[model samples]
Target: MSRFEKLSHVIWHCQYHIFWVPKYRYRILTGAVANEVYRCIQIYCGRLGCEIVELNVQPDHVHLLVKVPPKRSISEVLGAVKGRTAIRIFKQFSNLRKKPYWGNSFWAKGYCVDTVGMDAEMVRKYVKYQEQLEKQQEQLQF
Candidate 1:
């Protein structure tokens, strides 16, 4: 009845707030691209036995609230999500890897990740509030 995931020797709730952007911080993650990135991340994380508690794919970046297992290091989790998503996105949308970009890389080299434990609600609200604020900013520009 407990919420925490239980391994043979451990019971844990390792949630993280992960944010990463596209190469050059391009606003390429829109419409189909955003959907694809979200789907790919969900699939990849699921394969790793990780649970995505919340996710938001912004125009230039992505924010994910994921529950990772202790068996996998944070770097390993990021590698899997970012690496696999990049490959799949490039393959599905060939134009992304062509011309001026001159490379198949999709995500930037680094990411920002923070632990979301007792303060999970605060993080969730912050993410939601950010999206709302961004929306408002866009409205003002037009």
Candidate 2:
């Protein structure tokens, strides 16, 4: 295969799992707060030139399935998404302050990311079913 063909044929996809503490996992991601965070993430991901295929925003954590260009490093892509979102979230929702919501940070220290295979259909299915899996877990909890 030609170099251009080789490059064009390759596709890189990743799933990122991120967490945030509500001053210690207090579950502060409610209606408005969650919405704001989601919006910020959308913009941040767009700016980073990554496509957010799916997102599951829970009360304490978030799951994102993103497709990034092969030229971008995983760490750089995650940093852009996480860093920009954190800043925008803190700015838009001041209640995240310690005096209001929490003091120090919006997201936790680290994130989980994994690579997905080139099977596009499988990736699509995984993203689509993520919410159902969460619901099943919730049902089992009670």
Candidate 3:
């Protein structure tokens, strides 16, 4: 049997982080945008057969921690999330639909993803605390 054929019993948790285009910057990622992204993420995860443990939408990027079944690949899950969010964002924001919000691409090609083991508490905490950390960094800039 091939690896694809193997019936592995795995509960995989993954984190996906992706950024926006350069000129658009993080400014476009407001509370409204974040809420839309969050809603879209939930719907997309359901469609992809993944369980979203948590999600944090920052100014520059989005952090999603999801639990995927063994049959699913990490890349597949992230791609779904990114693709759906981008489409929804562009549709909702007419300005984004105009030239140059994404520069032909709604999201940067590269992303960061990490696999978590049984010890998922740390990862969960980090995801939950991401916004707080960003706020602290912003305060320090003053």
Highest lDDT: which candidate?
A: 1
Better of 1 and 2 by lDDT: 1
After superposition, the stretches of candidate 1 with alpha carbons farther than 4 Å from their true spots are 119-142
lDDT of each: 0.91, 0.67, 0.68
Return the lDDT, model 2, position 133: 96
- TM-score list, all predictions: 0.80, 0.63, 0.64
RMSD, model 3, all Cα superposed?
15.6
Sort all candidates by lDDT, best to worst.
1, 3, 2
Tell me which of candidates 1 and 3 scores higher on TM-score: 1
Error of 1 at 9 (Å): 1.2
Superposed model 3: Cα runs more than 4 Å off: 1-25, 99-101, 119-142
Better of 1 and 2 by TM-score: 1
Residue-by-residue lDDT tens digits, candidate 2, 1-142: 4212124667444444433343356576678877876787788777777677787777877777776666777778767766776677778766566355445566666677777554788878988799889999999999
- Worst lDDT 10-window in candidate 2: 2-11
Cα lDDT for residue 48, candidate 3: 78
Residue 78 of model 2: what lDDT? Answer: 67
